[model samples]
Target: MKQMSYMINQRYMKKLTCCFVCIFLLIGTVAAQDKEVKLKIVQTSDIHGNFYPRDFILQRDAVGSLARVYAFVQKERETYKDNLILLDNGDILQGQPTAYYYNYIDTVSPHVAAEMLNFMGYNAGNMGNHDVETGRAVFDRWAGDCHAPVLGANIIETATGKTHFPPYVTLERDGVRIVVLGMITPAIPVWLSENLWKGLRFDDMEETARKWMKIIREKERPDIVIGMFHAGQDALLMGGKYRENASLDVARNVPGFDIVLMGHDHARECKKVRNIAGDSVLVIDPASNGVVVSDIDITVTLRDGKVTDKKIDGVLTETGAYGVSDEFMKHFASQYATIQDFVSKKIGRFTETISTRPAYFGSSAFIDLIHTLQLNISGAEISLAAPLSYDTRIKEGDVYVYDMFNLYKYENMLYTMKLSGKEVHDALEMSYDLWTNRMTSPDDHILLFRDKPREGAADRAAFKNFSFNFDSAAGIIYTVDVTKPSGRKVTILSMADGTPFDMNKMYTVALNSYRGNGGGELLTKGAGIPQDELKERIVSSTDKDLRYYLMQYIEGKKVIEPRALGQWKFVPEEWAVPASKRDYEFLFGKVQE
Candidate 1:
């Protein structure tokens, strides 16, 4: 039986080798059609650690493997019969099991992701916030070994102005001169680790893009111009101007460009924007992590004075416009097989449902994960977990390490703050207010909106309930009942030893520097705290990459069961619904009218 099985395996191996050769052969012969140079461009945005279908777990039926992407691209090219251009919108590194397991180890790095990208035909890539999360040294190495160009126009080293990554590149495919320019989101301060960008300077995206626009126009003038930007509609093209104006504000302002692919905010555009001059500048963006691919077919028109209008057969430009494919998924699995196994061992199951609810006011599944980790890592009596609600739901069976990092994506440092009960409550209120405000104004900033509150303006009362998650502070415990008004949510606050929060005494609370410095405006606003001053304040971001550190720790652990920290509860009554809006609960939690 063993001999027979071995022979069968050898035969299968030969067949697979033949298939691989055939794929390459087919890729090589792909030529521009007679009428036009039909080319396909595949782009992905904000793919944070969601590489495999079953996450990093080595599961077959799960979706979103890069191999599937490759297969899809191949199939598209076969049908379209066009030249191909593959562009990544950035935020590629540190998104999936690949970034978590191997990229962190330095044993395997972004080169691994890039290599897979290159083997599968990624022509050009850009820098994402998460890419910088790994630090410059690792990024530099990854850039050195990359198969495609890593691009950013404005990002320059502080001590030296040399770019950390390439700004743009011009390529020729199917007799069409295509110029691709790169721009990363300018939100460096908000998303990146201070250490990674300490001395570096990332200028206004438009200024940098314009400067490159002229350089490329004069030096590398091409037939078609395309922008590969990490900044998206919210940052740049918020459609109509609002309070904050950003670089994409200049996308239309730039001359000598045809189409632009955008990222950063990870929003799919409503449609292509046309300049006042009547030039339709095609623009496209796919939602993060290869969920959907945007396809655009470019056709040019030119004529002499005699011929009024002529439809000149040009290039048929294409990108990812569909779903997961078996071929792409299978190849992606084989390449990252090492990473797949290293992250997907069973982490145990949850007997209860975990959610990101109460994210607006009190605590959540996302918040619960944070506190539990901080308490465990720092061994602090009170661990502070800053609320950054993304995706949630921890169920039975194998949970990938990649999922763990996504729940706590930031490379933030954990610090402890000593505050009185009042101080803690005040800070909680402030964070809650920010959460509510962010939800209310959810256009360019919030791509995720599972939590929202209706008070509209600055309502100091968002903090009526100062409930701490069981995981929010390990050595501490608290409960909140929505039956009471907003501020009085917390009826009891006590230490693990059963000591209540005393007005005269102080307690040590652990949290991230972003919270301590009061980025959330909760503690910064001094809301509800009728005190003379803040007890103590200290700020620390991160030294080693926190995301990478977490990934390394998970591989060694027996299990990482994420659970719901039973802290806050909903009011018995439902909130009033605004006739102006749709299902209000989808945005804001059910408000008690």
Candidate 2:
């Protein structure tokens, strides 16, 4: 009886031990399933091909570049490892000569923008209006060459009725899923020529965001949703017509987005916006030229394969503070050398030096040079041109290819449009209204000075409006009466050749494609032409960009002398002359002789 009892006890002890072991194993498995994940997301926007720490246009060493950004990103990667996500917010295919070189000059090779993005291991990128300005061939090739996806949820192909680029991209890290939806500003049609966008249609940001949010939540079921928008934070721009800068609008209206990244206006911002559901969403913009980047830290807690809690924080990291990466510089050294050679080639010669500073006060050789070219190239009776650069100088001597960049800042094509003589007068009235104030006394500012000057800002920042909108007309004689009001300030005297200026007749006017496309509302609002009717007025357009024609024109002339047309002047020289000098000193901090 004692032996039987001992055997039973031994068997029970063995079973109890097995049960304890099984419970411990189950506890270990549950503990492993519940985890905390930390991720770092870095974003670069409006880089504009600042690949090296050099300003190819100015031929000077500049602070912002992808080399500096690369260094900072690599340093962060050491801590985050595979948990790091890098993204670009578009406008990377314009601005610097580096982009122009690869975009048009080196047609056989892969785009430098794509090459650099791939080299930096970018997770995804979006399209910008300027990127679209590169036209179908260049941008399509760039999108194809990139290792990562180029996403634009609102850029739809008209024929297929589908997104031209991938709507979004998915990323996974340590069992966490992230979805990034990209959208460009719907204002492209308002600013860009239709041929540039061709068969693509831009949809409203709010509607696109709403559509993508539903799809992402229902299908992706991602742990986090991000918005990468090539737009500004301002919701009231253009009266929200096409929502040019709808980054804030989409964030406030869309429910599922946890974060939104913005660009296009070149303004730096970092803040949290409350959505319709009262949930806070982070929105950030790093501004332009790769000077800064958006850095975000995300902490996610998961239980039973579902996210229980999440915390997000974002800050702007100044790329200028970091040193340029030697590795990045070495890898693309050849391409950099080639671009340098291309820009250094001499195209023509200049007889005299000219500066755009005088453009704000009155007629300057700086702007007249462009006006001369446009009138000559397009055979237009009137030329409307603005000083694209607020203050840049092209010194006398041999003109290099890079000097053309200073001469003409944008890649706008030259356009000759038919405008009634009265329409031209109204346009000039609008331009001067934006450019100068209606002075009641000599003490009043001549230029439209801001009510409160921005401290330590560029000289142009002191103005009430962008200086690029300050258009002056050549090929016509006119006078601006400063004592009068906005509508009555401009007075048309006669044509530059002393022909009668008839308001009833239509005249050929030469302007950039930007203005022709109603970029600043000069044609639509001032000229009283319907937005849709502006296209009908186009008499002709150059095959290449204005800069190309300007270069060719200069080369043909060999040694060109640029002079102001002296066709227009400000009346009541007593009040105008002193005010002009005072305003020039106030803006430029230098007294005119």
Per lDDT, the best of the predicted structures is 2
Report the C-alpha lDDT of model 1 over 1-593, residue by residue, as the tens digit.
99999999999999999999999888655532133444556676666655555555223344444544565677767765547677777777765556655555655434667666666677788887667766776666766777878888878877888776778888876556678888776655433345666777676677777788888878876777778777666542211122122434655777556777766554455355665456656666665655556555554322221212222222222223445556555655654667656655544444444454444434455566666666666565566565443324444445555455545555555555666666666554443333332222213222112233312111121223222211233455665333333355444467666777565566666666444444333454533332223223433333554554455555556456665565543222132113112223543446521
Could you tell me which 10 consecutive residues in candidate 2 have the lowest summed lDDT?
452-461
Each candidate structure's TM-score, on Cα atoms with residue i matched to residue i, is: 0.68, 0.94
lDDT per residue for candidate 2 within 449-538, as digits (tens), equals 788654223435688877888899999999998889978999999999998999999999999998998877778778788878889999
- Give the runs in model 1 whose Cα sits over 4 Å from its true position: 1-39, 57-60, 79-82, 106-110, 236-248, 276-278, 301-334, 345-366, 379-383, 386-391, 395-411, 416-427, 434-509, 513-593
Clash count per candidate:
29, 0
TM-score of 1: 0.68
Q: Where does model 2 exceed 4 Å of error?
A: 1-34, 236-241, 450-460, 591-593
Clashing pairs in 2: none
